[model samples]
Target: MSESLVQAIASNQPELNVEMLEDIEIEKLGEGNAATTKEKENEKSKKRKTGAPAERIALCKYIILDELPFKAAEKEGFKIFVAEICPMFQISSGYTSGGCKREFSVSPRLTDIVGKSIGELLVDVVTQWLLPRLFSCTLDNAAANDVAMRHVHSKLNARNILATNGQYLHQRCVSHIINLVVEGLEDIGMSVIRGREAVKWINASPSRSRSFKDIAKIAKVDTSKFLCMDVPTRWNLTYLMLEAALPYEPAMRLFQTMNPYFASDLKERNHRKMSIGVPTELDWIEVKRMCGFLEQFYNLTHLVFGSHYFTSHQVLMELCDMIGLITDLEEDEDDGFRNMVMRLRLKLGKYWLEETKLNPKMNKILYIAIMLDPDPRQKMKHVEYCLKLVYGSTWANELLE
Candidate 1:
């Protein structure tokens, strides 16, 4: 906050108690980690005589979209908004008001994702929301808000930071879009069936769905002429393109009939790695699946992302719906914990886009949350992708130009 604002508040309060004013928690501008360094050093100094080797820090990472504006940087005509990720291991200490306030125990790691998503959101708020009223471009630079934003960016850079949602946070970001596509699959009547029982298969034992995939292959051959037509089946983006061309009703029925877990046996299912959010993190396979769902969207065919269902508009509505249904997702635990963590993740995924900064147009249509692989070694892969989209090719280099 600016000093002027602080003074205004202090003067308003007759008592002028500095401590009480200081106690109010401001949103994280990345200061949470300063306290942990001294403690770490003290431990090392004490342990030197006993001389056990110090513990190693294991780094965790994940990949977000390899680019921006869905890939091309400012070619989409937007500014870059960067975020620094700060993870806080915390503690609580008592205070006069009541009990304790939480304090961070370590420093935050920072990374720059400054690109279309952040820029658009900030611009949207400024232009569509604040500019028309709070400030006018016709006027010159205003005060606090812009200044606060710059300071926040500085703090993020001074501290080593992660993108918001950090590594796991990426999972949350893309899942919002994935969940929308999954729900879109449901829209063309994929959730119901006829004959022996469509609804039954859907509600059937997970194994029952396995039998349906087999049935679909048989049906494919038998109805060879009919199956030859394009169908929209976006279990992922490529599948979605194929599914989009088919007759909706049959395409959906085909989808519901497809078993998502065909390759695995029950033992494999049980052993499928996952983390209980409260207990531990997910295993690599589950993590890969999360990345796979997102990566598929940016692959070969999606050069242009906006469309009927795929457009930022439709994709965003589905996300808002997920947020509205948060209670139902929570109730999923009521069934007792088989894939409960995954299910809960699916639920949280719905809200993931809400975290991204988007223009109202994009915001209303799509939420673009992003997570990045923290290992800087992999950073170049994503950066290369962004460069391709931004510069059109490394040689053209308009961003550089």
Candidate 2:
């Protein structure tokens, strides 16, 4: 809505549907239902459809750290442990192949006593559990496509990305797996990276089959050793499937090669980036799936992101630019960074209401693309005396498969 209308509502126009926040609603009782209802009503019946699992999922739509597993603070031996958290914790849940909702949580306990904060811990989890799992699977269909993978992984760097699981989760989730190596080479500790690179080269090469035997012999490793595992199963995305993988020389070679700069970079003080303004409702299962998908590509993710050529932030900016959201990319390249609140003034006759379309899918794409915008906090607002022909409210949450 327009700032003027918001101001008016906040001022003397209380009847215009503005209510000041006087209290916090810890219970998610009457919230989001209207968005849900409106979403169901407005979502057009399209030809495209995806998998629909039968299991019940508890989408964390919106949660607070206070609502997490830990209660207040605990008395550990000599100290009282407390959750040092930001103001919000937003997440989501979706059904798996078997109808199970997979929600995720990094080892806050692991990161806590271990020193890092929860957000950092989630990143580490993505490195370990998430990336590893991605390597264990193969991309086959539209559901298992590479382009989709790229969309998901690049989003990791967003501000507040850790707090929610919006549609962005599926964007390039597969590509994120492929990008693992890009992420790893920045740290030089991995000897296995080279071998894995060889595997990737072979898989990605024209003469892959012919070079396979020779590649294994030169690396003194054998891919044949990985026979017992079911190859690329779905859960492999979660477990990282390393247990099923033959840890022989062949497998070792593929897993060892990583970035030297990464280790050194890891030792350096971490520079924190701002959170993206989009809200999410992420789940542990998707996190696990994200982990499984990232395995081999963990180092790659580091590499892609580390390159001075193009940062994750830049990529997202390009996306937003394509949608005409980021104007004048050549001059003020950083305009996408502010909180964008699109102010809408639909001029019409006295008794008529103006209608507008806020397609959820387009909104999602815009939201993800905005993360890459040069500005981290850009938001939009629309102003109207009345929302005509619209569902219920200007703000809504839509669920799609």
Candidate 3:
């Protein structure tokens, strides 16, 4: 096999000649033992014939499952590894691997991305893929998604493929709902805005970042975690930004004292005048309080988005905890904290409360999931207790009925 490979390389590569092949020594296995050379040759021939195709198939599966680049097979190291395992098999080139056709097709859509257009496009894709049935489609909390789901529900119902008449066909994305709830608290005060400005200034350049690290080191703050800037649209990112910056509060203050230019730089960039500036002592205190409040929502969001296990049964319990958190925070002495919790409560009520007209009814699936919990401690009784806590005994009784 090595001899053949050498010959092939010499033939293909203009730089290599037949003379170079003379210096290459090919080792003969099972050379002088009990077995004859003829028997060894026959065994190798049989192995090559039987193992080559299976090895090739396994290689293909590896590439596809790992999402590796097609050019991986063309590398010299890869060819050598293949030779060591299955010497008789010929390694395919990157172009050959890339040329293998996929089982799916891509269709371009030039239409607007509204509900009707999205619904039609989804139906077309489902048909093209020959999907027999779809249990549900999860989407974010967009008004357009509501319309899209309704269109999809009608189309699926016409074909008699829907279970429960498509009642559960539109599964609202839990993470997105959590985002909406957390976003209600985003306007807590100038504290958040100032904190965001601080992070932005620190991360603006390599020199600033290095200087901050030096300050952090001197303050004995953990230099392992770099400051993170938050996107206003994502509450989770904002939570992360605050969480990262909280520990750096000491470092930030020290840096500000050491570098008078820091505050001046922020002030110079403050076109939003009243809204943007360096974080004050009160700002850090408010940020700390906000972090404490946002932590629960951030954790709940993470749990719901987990991929290792089904999280439906866990949803109601976490949401019940959220209700408890909001109710407790409502009594906080800080007026800003209480106001923020009130807003969060209103947002939660819009989606989870039974009587709110914003959502005509709470999704029955959440209740069904909790009832299906296998744990004796977390069965229907626990759900009833939570409901009673939120809606009182009378409303809980009505819901139970």
Question: Among these predicted structures, which one has the highest lDDT?
Answer: 3
TM-scores for candidates 1 onward, in order = 0.21, 0.16, 0.63
Superposition TM-score, candidate 3 onto the true structure: 0.63
Model with the higher lDDT, candidate 2 or 3: 3
C-alpha displacement of 176 in model 3, angstroms?
A: 1.8
Tens-place lDDT digits, model 3, residues 261-360: 8888877765345636688899999999888778988888988898898888888888888888888889989887788788888888877777423244
Per-residue lDDT of candidate 1, residues 227-252 (tens digit): 11112344453233222222223433
What global local distance difference test value does model 2 have? 0.31
lDDT of 2 at 89: 18
Looking at candidate 3, the ten consecutive residues that score lowest on lDDT are 103-112
Q: How many residue pairs clash in each candidate?
A: 29, 107, 0
Of 1 and 2, the candidate ahead on TM-score is: 1
List, residue by residue over 248-333, the lDDT tens digit for candidate 2: 33433332233233223223422233222111123222333233333423333343456356343333233222223212212332
